[model samples]
Target: MQPFPSQPLDHDSLHEECGVFGVIGVPEAANFVALGLHALQHRGQEAGGIVAYDPERGFNGAHRFGYVRDNFTKASLMETLPGALAIGHVRYSTAGSKAPVIRDVQPFFGELAMGGCAIAHNGNITNAAALRRELIERGSIFASGSDTECIIHLMARSIQTSIPERMKDALRRVEGAFSVIAMTRTKLIGVRDPLGVRPLVLGTLHDGAHVLASETCALDIIGAEFLREIEPGEMVVISGGEVASVRPFAPAQSRFCIFEHVYFSRPDSIIGGRSVYETRRQIGVELAREAPVEADMVCPVPDSGTPAAIGYSQESGIPYAMGIIRNQYMGRTFIEPTEQIRDMGVRLKLNVNRALVKGKRVVLVDDSVVRGTTSRKIKDMIIAAGAAEVHFRIASPPTAWPCFYGVDTPHRDKLLAAQMSPEEMRDWIGVDSLSFISLDGLYRAVGEAQGRDGACPQYCDACFSGDYPIPPSDQIANGGFDPEGPTTLSDHTAP
Candidate 1:
């Protein structure tokens, strides 16, 4: 396995860690997992893996370094991982570098003292480095740089008698956000962190098989009925056609990642009982009420910003137009690892529509601005396309702080919002005007009408508010920079 390396900070956009999916009591379980992972492909694109458990075959695993459609869809690959219980992961590296090695791919399996188990995890472990050091001192051998691998090793060392008990023991020793799905020979398990920093939902298929996934969309893909969200600090174990709930951790105020409604989750998915697309549109409505702009048309940055822009246009009574067109074939540019490729910027993914933008005062609605690089490039493109004026409106508040949870955010110094005031950013991006939704407005958009409470906020807004629900132990200990500075840990784990 490759050693962990510091990745160069990419200022364009934030990335969520990964997505987990699991199913039990289903025939051809690996195939169902593949479909679930495909629905959640938006969460991670670099690598995908599935682990299945059969009484006869024991545990069979398949790990691939590419899109789920390209890897997990093939019948040959699915056939190789046959079983009645399965768990899968689509990975976006938050800890390690951009490497494509198989070892870094997930659904990491281990033969533990209790039983054989395979685990897939979403979210970052802020104390992974420290935990790794402690485990190493105890003679634990690691096969991958992934922090998820640390959980497997922790389980192996646990003195608990059952797999579920051992998992709880392992989780209690770690810190930061996590939504885990693990499978053993006869059971499947799912757990969310105390704060529910990342999302995990439970569903049931038509055949009465239980399903656990990062989002409701994953459940929708397989005609699964949305049962409910996995409660914070709760674990559900499925076996023998029965689902048992276990509360292994003390109750804490929930701090689900707010970015999920902003960009991480698929628009079709419902989070916190709110439609993700509707919430984004509501955010646009809130943005319009909070920061109205006079313009010929309201335009989105594309794909990510589309729903919010529509809401803005409707609320403002301004006509919405396709002022910017996106290249659907291109992957997200922010995930590009090398400076050379990322320096090319938004041009590879988006283009300004001269017909719609020329001679028009365009209002550009986007999810959020991180580095100002992409926004600056986009502003220039709009002006060049003959836009008389470019007004920038963001759905979320300025991202002034780094996220140590599942989201891949830049360090404090690298964040544009952290470094400059709104006016300064407007001048730097060369836009006529720029406005971000107020923190209260953001909360209102997400259905928290009273707005965020200073003492007990409704959701995790650390990226926007700097009020971290959990302390970043490793960062605090190491002076906030990884030992390896801006170096790729692996070749293909960029996002």
Candidate 2:
């Protein structure tokens, strides 16, 4: 077995997966959709796609494996694309499937008895193996090894009377987090999984056009006024320029992943009607009220850690400084193709501002630390940069178990905090002091849990407290990444 933390977190407290944008309005819809997708490019830079529907041409899927700007141009889109309704997807593969290779591009296209179904998915499903087996047994063929493919197959096999009915029924059978945008011959539809583990928002343009996206930022770029989010466990169908919902698949509940506000969604966006930036600021205020620390300067780890650090500094009456500088051009360290490159990625990814950190007792505010390896290296770098003493504060709780839904976290041993005591973890990370935000305090930081109903609450705290909102596969099996298989162009090395 590989050495790994039993569980890891999926949300980094910054940068979310791909965004989906669709327009069901006018003839220029394809062009407007492309422009909206450009706004969502940050969610996934590795790939971009837009599938436009034309009655004369059926459904056309255009994909490129690169940044949106580089892959598409107004001229190319104008020349090759034409339609009144189009759906687009940007991608960040949680699995190693994501790559610069053209074959790895998304808006996965497939033709079924029900007509053309182009699916763009965000988040992972834990029960995918079981569902895949069920489909394979029923004689459905699959093209890719992605969990997203499982959904296409399921939708094809459902005995529902209509395509939309079959799609919703297919979703009912799958378990885990998912928010998907599916484009059909004459419709653009959005579906969020039962728990609403992922987010999907709806909007409309001035010309009576309906738009759907993962975040409001995408809508903003395309000038679509915000509508409402596709309700959790609900399906919104847009056909013939009309929008309506399928029955709520699961009981309406707010199991929205809390991590989104802390790290994933951009601060400028509003999630579930609340400002993420303001939420993070409130978190900082709460963290200060609950766990105050004295230090010469409060410095965040950079990017995700910045806003919270500002809040902490402001509430604690300490000065806030930009103690760390990120190498903005550094590609994903996890995506580095070689170990040597991965090591260099860490060094080049973040550089401490010696002038800000040196000779000062610094308070380090980081979103969360995964396997202790990265934090240890970060600590060494800061010390080398000449900080007098470094104290670490995790804005979230420790991750002790792997997440089965969407996050690639597998196994428990890789987590530094799994079996070790706080002091042991602190020593392991080589920090002067360490403390994670308390679990209760963490919920209070979000402040949306207004009730405690039977069983569970509105949020998913499984990764932190070992209480899964849903059950994992109980089959007695032990296997993972087939190391002998032909390697694809990806980065699936140690996390």
Candidate 3:
């Protein structure tokens, strides 16, 4: 077992989502997968579980209501969840309603119209309610309010001849984004939406074992070498210890979420062969090239901003120091039960190291600012710690629209940039000055195609540019933002 390091989670993460892992063709797949999921514990800490299958016992699982480390110890797992293939989940509810109820745990299983299957998914489905209605009319009974349940029903009732056929039908029918790992008595499958709005990777162990996960970090933890990224609209199936690929969707263009590099994915993990560390560093390099500042020291918010802070320091010749310390034990701000608590979440989430910033002219490097409340507090913390001056630099463009895929971005009016200019935001956050990387600069930071200027062709820039690939219908948005009733996919599901 790995040592657990506490981080004051973005207590006001203001959003929720999660990570997932699946391993096939290994004798002790669940054991290996548990370790892998632990590595990605930072992606989501709400709940975790692993489901394992063997031809003999079939579908055995161990689930719990806390962090992966809090449950499923190595000793306890030896007596349960023994199998050659497995799937795991770590959730931060982009859809599920609030409640620490264990029923919200994943690797949901049930008897299918054709047979039985178990699934754990990461991402949001925009058209789930519509799909649920369509399937409910066909006599489907759902156990969860999540859109993922809709996929389960669709898979069971599909007219396709094979399991992959049924999955493909379900995939084609769903809108929004999905990076799912599912299993049947005989098959293991992984899929991504056509837009690649979310991330999914395919990898292999030296023993010829196949693995699939939402982040490459999972594979790294379990000693699996990433084979390649699962292409958008592609599905990989493992049956009889052999792997097969299926590309059922037409050749639509790809739009890998660019934010993955900026905020998601562990810096140590690689996506599409690009190290997240290098990517964030590149963002720092670009930020420096686009907006250079005169300051005494460069400091990062904490955790996610450290690598970028190092990059900014390297590029700008500013000395970097550990200025902010995250209180690893805090829950996500978004996970906090009340709005007042969320607004104050950051104060408890991090502490300004007075020794590092006292009387120093500080340059603050962060990935991005959302509602600006969090950043505003960070500035307050720094000023209270005696910083002489503060300049803020963001690694990505300002988010102008809400994300339609899985990202739980804040609403339009709550956005700092929407209501105020950079100067205004600087004043609001109490920073001496603020400058954000340009869209062109952000593209360069991520290594966009040559000669393409700053646009990321394979990037989903809808949230920043208001260029939504598939805009949400008005009624859908109404239902989506609802915190009460069964308005949200999470609210309808078993929270």
Candidate 4:
């Protein structure tokens, strides 16, 4: 496997995997699915796709390389997908290259001996390369470069007489984080990996339709009543407006991604019945308590850092100020695929408020620092704007390891934390002082008051601690593990 080309700006942050949404028993299901995808646009912005099942048309799919609102909102486009059941995906390339063609945009549909199934997946398959090699050796032709296509091929070759059984068989052979929404001719299915590293939620429409989404924000957009989060190792098949649940794999302790509370989820989303915004604010409070500093004002790094900054201000008795303003029209810097565009960097989206920062000892709060590029640039911008001093407070621990599950993280060598100590980073970024929240404090912020349990941890902190819940088979097979890697995964395998 070729090493991904370095994008200096993007190396500083993590990118979320795709978002999946599906609905059954809803009239014009594509419309509702569209709204759900629109709400989940933050998860992935590279591409969007929808697949709908109509009795007359069988399976109709529309995959486009753009935003859902721009592609799926048109009457002509929505008219192309007519059905009572639909599944959709908003994608960011974590597996294959960043420049994906239309075919890679998913809701990947495959026809099997049992029936046609369309799947929208939100996570990585750790054993995908091995599985792909085995399937290819068995003469299974592939339609896309995505690791997700491996699941479809596995299901097609299954001897099971039903789609759900075939799906279970397929999932059993793979490893890593996965929250999938699939649609068959008669049923809509949702499944979470046994360890539940990724998130998936179930909801119900007032008219008796069942909905599955990667986040509750999607359900809120469509006015669906929140049901509950899909459990680890569980699969649900929705038919005739009723849901049938099954435990397809042996149960294991849940390992939800801790970073979701830090940056991935929308502020309004509720995960594990806890408000995401509240969790972030609590993280800020924890940071303030752990790393108190004297400053005239607390300023966030625009959007992702805003909630935590507010929390830090409240806890420290300092006033929160908007010393840097983000351009509402600009998208996230990490989403820009090309190195040329990313090199343009922080200036494209954020501008310092000279009036607020000038002559002020500002405390800059951000979620986390990856490669240090963004933080360094922001510090420079603050100094240029005449700030007296800048203190950097990170809401989460230093991100020292790469994520093998679903997040698009830089390789070990490129991560700033992997190479530098906290003091070194502070000197490099030219901040007066720098501090990150402790790992245990992060757990406490997410409601784990006892801190992370060593025997059975509550969340996945692989990016910080290198304690991956599942082995990264593909990465290991490719000899991608470095001796200098920041952290190590626990010796465990999914049951």
Provide the TM-score for each candidate, comma-separated.
0.93, 0.87, 0.89, 0.95
User: Higher lDDT: candidate 1 or 4?
Assistant: 4
CA RMSD of all predictions: 6.1, 6.4, 6.6, 3.0
Steric clashes per prediction? 10, 15, 17, 0
Off by over 4 Å in 2: 1-17, 95-104, 333-342, 449-455, 474-495
- The TM-score between candidate 4 and the true structure equals 0.95
Residues 307-412, model 2: lDDT tens digits:
7888888899989998888878664423556656644535667888887788888888887776766677678888998888888877877877566555545356
Angstrom error at residue 1, model 1:
41
Question: In model 2, which range of ten residues has the least summed lDDT?
Answer: 486-495
Residue 49 alpha-carbon offset, candidate 1, angstroms = 0.5
Q: Model 3 misses residue 399 by how many Å?
A: 2.0
Q: How close is candidate 1 to the true structure, as a TM-score?
A: 0.93
Whole-model lDDT values for every prediction: 0.86, 0.72, 0.76, 0.89
lDDT for residue 485 in candidate 4, whole number 0-100: 55
**Candidate with more favorable, higher TM-score: 3 or 4:** 4
TM-score-best of 1 and 2: 1
Q: What lDDT is obtained when candidate 4 is compared to the true structure?
A: 0.89
lDDT of 4 by residue, 329-392 (tens): 8854336676677666778788999999999999999989987878888999999999999999
| lDDT digits (tens) for residues 136-220 of candidate 3 | 8889887766667777788887888776788888877777778999988777899887778789898888666888888888888
Which predicted model would earn the best TM-score? 4
